[model samples]
Target: MLTIAPAQAPSAADLWAVLTALRLLDDAAEDAAAARIEAARLTDETRWQAAGPRRLRQALTEYTVHLARLADELWFQRDQIARNALG
Candidate 1:
């Protein structure tokens, strides 16, 4: 007769790898935010007279919020994995 075992949870190293990737993604999001700010500053007042600047800022804000949420979730997961390892 053949038998099967239950699948194991992710190892600490695996969790670390996910955390590292999340950090990299956060770094990229930060870079994007900086670039967006610089681009807005470089735009002329005439362009701001239109709706472009307002729309761009709104989009940037939304994207930043999304990134923040993702980062928060990743941090939460990383902490949970660490606690599981310890206890």
Candidate 2:
């Protein structure tokens, strides 16, 4: 599948919505990263523990991976808009 999404220049209202969505997506990615960091710290705190902390780390790993992918996709779309506008 194509990783980049095409973009169309939006009207003022649509642009606002797009910006808001981008902000939210960025925030989500950041939150996921924070979760992963927290999970790492938790693991460090209990090195021998294999159940809850490991599960939490796994969840954060999944969340961060997915959100980072989404953030990349969204940023690609946003950049496409800039390229279109420039060209």
Candidate 3:
């Protein structure tokens, strides 16, 4: 038989760090979304003719969507953490 140790509670500093990181992630997600829009506009305007502007735009759009989903997940986690901490 084996015994497992109980999980330790997170410290205030740890929670603060996680919250800060979440904020940064949210900011990055917003930036990525803006970049995706700009990429699409540039590709459509024919000014970003860099051999594969369409491909670049597609990749940026995908990246932006992924970042947005990740931000949503992190926000949910942050909310859960807050609820737990408060209760």
Candidate 4:
């Protein structure tokens, strides 16, 4: 998902929303990882049903990283805007 920060100053509300979404995504990734581990424990050597959950966990991990980058960029941009305002 592509998140475009607003052209205007970043509001506290916007940051809060992003943080909440990130938390939920983190929780889901953790659950998926747990499921993968359980599947590994329960399944036989020949069984490979955990692949889907494993892939999901990886994807979620990547998504979290992407969101974190976005958040960082948002803060940097907000800081730049503030500096420009101060000058």
Candidate 4 stretches greater than 4 Å from native: 1-49
Candidate 1, poorest ten consecutive residues by summed lDDT: 39-48
The 10 consecutive residues of candidate 2 with the worst lDDT sum are 78-87
What does the lDDT come to for candidate 1?
0.61
Give the per-residue lDDT of model 4 (tens digit) for 1-36: 999986786578866765565556556555655555
lDDT winner, 1 or 2: 2
Q: Residues 42-69, candidate 1, lDDT per residue (tens digit)?
A: 4333244458777776666666566566
- lDDT at position 33, candidate 4: 51
Worst 10 residues of 3 by lDDT: 39-48
Q: Which candidate model has the greater TM-score, 1 or 3?
A: 3
Q: Find the 10 residues in a row with the least total lDDT in model 4.
A: 39-48
Measured on C-alpha atoms, candidate 4 has an lDDT of 0.56
Most accurate candidate by lDDT: 3
Write the residue-wise lDDT of candidate 3 on 11-70 in tens digits.
999878767766775676567556656655654565455768767766766665665566
Q: What ordering of candidates by lDDT runs from best to worst?
A: 3, 2, 1, 4
RMSD in order of candidates: 7.2, 8.4, 6.1, 12.5
Best by TM-score: 2
Order of models, best TM-score first: 2, 3, 1, 4
Error of 3 at 56 (Å): 12
